[model samples]
Target: MGFRDIAMFNDSLLAKKAWRLLKNPKSLFNKVFKARFFPNYTIMEAKHTSGGSHTWNSILHGRDVLLRGCWRIGNGKAISIWQHHWLPRKHPPQVLSPMVDSLADAKVAILIEETSRQWNHEMIDGIFTPMEAKLVKAIQLSRYEAEDSLFWPFTNDGIYTSKSGYRFLKAEDQSEVEEEQRANLLRLNKTTISSHQIAATAKERLAEFALTIPRPQYPRVASTPFQTRWLPPSQGLVKINCDDATFKDQKKSGIGVAIRDENGMVLASMAKHLRQLYTALEIEAMAPSTALTFATQVGFHNGILESDSLVLTTALINNSTYLSTDGLLMEDIRFNASYFNQLLYSHVKREGNKVAHKLVRHALCILDFSVWMEDVLPPIRSAVLDDIVGFS
Candidate 1:
């Protein structure tokens, strides 16, 4: 709600009545007046007879004496006087003297004290320093004013200054500062890279050597359940499409696969970027496996697996005895064959696999995983379908 609503809700009459009974100001005032008179016969005692000599006397001088006794001793009295004398009354009571006339100004002083306390609390809470909080609040409040004017008159610049203001920075000066920050961050990143470069290089070499070594009779087997229970049941016949990419220099590869039911509705689509010592054959085996895994994950337990690798598909059907080589590649092929048996693996021409080829190209640009599930496929006219399904 707005400030007006807050003011109305916290009606002072309700607050004043509560304070009167709970606080018992008459008893408190008598105690304070007696303490001043009996103990020291102080100036505060003499001034007390004037029915409020100056609003500042009670606020400044009175609070000072009370604080000297003990800072907490008269907190309630000080706050009470602050509220009654200083703050605007819905109906101002009768005033007796000039000192009482100055009560209006006490509101400003009490507000400053309260604001300072709030600022200090924020500083302790680690949001901002006291000075920054004050300055920011001043700036925020200034927006509500009709014209630019000082909130506090003590500062030469008409605004509070503190340690934060030692360097004056305008918004226009930020670009250079930001550029310097970026440069420093990049330098630190480079230093970190250099520190770890030797260890990383050694690790890479070890991985390469491990890949080169052959494992003896460590029969390579594909992960099961994927082949036996993963593929979706197909009606009539399904068209399959696939494509593969090999990065020979980076020794990395990826594959894409898509299967459409007889009515040309997509049953499943998959793409995977593989981390491996790349070869065309590795890309071939990875293509079908990736498709099969994706199909399984999406609950497509009986769909055909498609790939643009005739050799790979043939080997799967022939119990993997036709694998081209020994070593890691042979093991990978054997595992892929076992996986293929679990799914309805099929070979498709590169031309028939244009949709999957496009998907593979798209996969290369993907920095992270993404998926799209359709309640219904968006309609495609004959021209769009022809573009996706290229003739061999």
Candidate 2:
């Protein structure tokens, strides 16, 4: 993208105007443009007239540059699930499945739960293949109501900058050059480039890059790190420790919860092997939810819900806002905890959560969710003893 040629540079600048129109339809300039050129449709849908003005022609050129843009899905009301570029993970970035006649012209909102702003999992599974369903479920909806917006993904802020637009042009140009050279020059026994070199060369724009800075001064102070050890709850309360792990190779996730009395004796524990995978933060939030239910089922109305996840512990304790699918998960966690007569969220380091960690690891050997009552499982015997010994 360095030193964009005159033609592409102008196109990049024009693309900025297009972006502004899409970002701020309420702006006077955008409103005027829309009324004149595309009254019934969006700028993207605007057609070329028999004799359009130069300004309109330039905007269309910029709109061509915007073909690479995608929608950062929110309410999904305006986005077509089958037609729009919404699925971030897929190649071509749209639903590959043919539109069902029964649900023709359906908006992306159809796949979402209107009340909760969450994916309709059963509907997703019904509409898509297993792989597609996984991708759809993985997309976290905004916690609060948010409208769909088009954005360029190449830039950090998701706003289309002239620089990013220029980079797209430069990359496209480089690819065409390489293709022509390989087809014509390489076959004639001319100087040839390796496939690896071709890509590196095409993408290489920076000749020299470095940071000019001074090294930091050394600190003489020394400190001791906190050692992690599980703490017992007060009398008449059980403390439940929660942890979770994701297995990418196996395409699954697991959660472990251990409920112990003030004496550090395990009252009940659970290891669940989920059939589906979730993001780390989502799983972390879910772990506490599972723990709450496990303790409640055992008739423990008062307990300390503990975990190594500081994000969740702080969030639950503060009842703060978190922005997406994990936010929804936190809601469920607190909802489950509502069943407890007395509840608390506490955080500890990994060493203190060894029992829960080991129990979740044991989940790999199992097929589905499992729970233990009135006994310590063999896989986590050592971890349970460690906590008990620490308690004493």
Candidate 3:
């Protein structure tokens, strides 16, 4: 079996065990509690209670790892602003100093305007530090007025998984590497950018930097409407349609990419959430970058890439120019696009790309990035089916 099959099989086995040990009330150990198992709240809250059976002790032992990647979504009533990890940005939203006594015990709801059901900007501005205030302002209010809820940051379905947990822990190593790279880049910048050069022609240098970057071998083909319908890839090829959804208020966005066979049957898909970004177009540009990365990793050679972003489409077709920071990103995109032995880029209208759009929206609410092969996620299944039906 392939990697995808192995991953699915392992996940299936884990899901089955999780259901039995955690959700099945009829299980002997669950019967001891006389209640359903709650890994996050109930069991975790009772951590100090004198332990019971081996199973319960084992579950408690694993809680620490699980809790590391989980965060609370505050609805105001059920979670305290200061006590809980309600803000999704960090493990616990960083506060350099403790809050004043007046607001020490305040509920997250206090920051919500009762009538508007949104953040009370005045209250937030008056109380929080600038950084904290920005984070608070970016938070999306609870729409259903539901109590605080636990979110698993490692899974697309908001369900916990060992793979996600490992990924969460692995990020620390990646961060360290990134930090070192950033420091080196800063040192280079300081050494290379002379005072005369900085004053002489900043635009000229910027343009030079943009053009100096090497690009892929993909021909500079202007993006044209290939097939407006949900057409599949040609035989022996895969079509990857990618889209990005931005949640400006939440300071987050998601990338949705779907890969399909010539029959229009989905082979794999991804919905990945990222921290809030500067521009939607930047994120849009990322769709192709991500798609190409996944394609090359999976050993796909011939592919056609589709996106709804005209800006990204144009950038890829035309020669690089120092228009903005996006020019740098476009250079990277072009370099990656060359990985496929035969790759083509196309632009499609939003209507023809609903499946990818839906996938991106679904990604926004998820805690971690998700990838599916063979089995499509429930949210995007209908969208996938709709595309297939259109071919009929």
Candidate 4:
């Protein structure tokens, strides 16, 4: 459906009847207008008016959903330069200035040279602020004479989707909810603390608070001569062990992926450095998706993915649905997993995933993302050799 379709459906049957009446200027709608039978008759236009039906009110409530993801592909005629959402930020091209008179009534066409179908830079520079001028110049003018059209900015293909719309709307609420949750945690100690900047005094108090909880002790296990060793994949499949490490002080996270063949020979290895603030759990949850992306890069069609995060592994397997930000990450993980011919996730002990752990540490100091194949890092090579020898 198009914008007109949405406008029509806002009051579907009544709007259609009104359209027929308006088309016939001599109809009863126009004749009775002097009698104040109806206040306005431009039902086809997308404008806000009071006292509409329930459907129209609902559509008005949802206008922002459609507006936010939309941008105008200008032929420079139908769009208003200062009033419409034609810019990349889903707002008007110009920020409001004290002297608005110069550009207030100007259509976007005023900035375009009609014959050349190119922007008039001098006009734009003279009429717009520096930032607005930059934005105006950056727009690629279309040579074709098609009228201005609404384009979806969220998708690569430039098509509006219900899925994208849902995400766009939900993200606004989700962010506020997340911020509230974080605020509540900081308020526990009656201290105002920023999660991104936890002070040393606050850290000590948090650590002390953590220590106050009683520990559940388990009976000691008898030492066994055998140790858990890294296992290989089945004949046709490769195995990838992935891990994540976060440095809170640095506000950075690292992910490592190690792919091994059926004979336990290292096929490829990848490590990446991410400069973002995430909790340990969020970083851990990110590992499987990062690992799968690496696996696809290495041309692996089928694989067994391993991670030391049981929570992440279970979430990947859909043991329970998550409603948090991790849920969005899990959705992405599932979508990426579908690209593989066959993919399975398994929970491994930290000892079993030692090589990946080492890679995680290796990634921390690296300035850029790196991928190593045949000639693996010395530390990883040592770990592989020990696994091959079945060393305890």
Best by the TM-score measure:
2
Clashing pairs in 1: 227-342, 230-301, 231-301, 231-302, 231-303, 232-301, 232-302, 232-303
lDDT of 4 by residue, 173-210 (tens): 55567688878877785554444455777888989999
* TM-score, model 4 to reference: 0.46
> Which predicted model would earn the best lDDT?
2
- Point out the worst 10-residue segment of candidate 2 by lDDT: 205-214
**Regions of model 2 farther than 4 Å from truth:** 1-80, 83-97, 107-133, 137-226
TM-score of 2: 0.58
lDDT of 3 by residue, 307-372 (tens): 888767765666434223233355556767777788887788887788788888889777988888
Tens digit of lDDT per residue, candidate 1, span 164-235? 121111211344565676688787884323322668888999999999999788877988442111122257
Q: How many backbone clashes does candidate 3 have?
A: 3
TM-score ranking from best to worst?
2, 4, 3, 1
What's the ranking of the predictions by lDDT, best on top? Answer: 2, 4, 3, 1
Superposing all C-alpha atoms, what RMSD in Å does each candidate have to the true structure?
Answer: 29.5, 8.8, 17.8, 14.2
Compute each candidate's TM-score over C-alphas: 0.33, 0.58, 0.43, 0.46
Model 2 clashing-pair count: 0
Q: Mind giving the per-residue lDDT tens digits that candidate 2 earns over 1-392? A: 35558789899999999888877889999999988888887887787887789999998899888866777777888888787777755246788875688877899898999898879999988888787777788776655666666767666446688998988788778777888988898688898775548567755533223233455899889889888899999999999998999999988899988999998889998899987777787788778888888888889999899999887788788987543335556666877878989998799999999999999998888888788896668868887788888868
Better of 1 and 4 by lDDT: 4
The residue ranges of model 3 lying beyond 4 angstroms of the native Cα positions read 1-31, 34-41, 72-74, 91-97, 170-224, 229-392
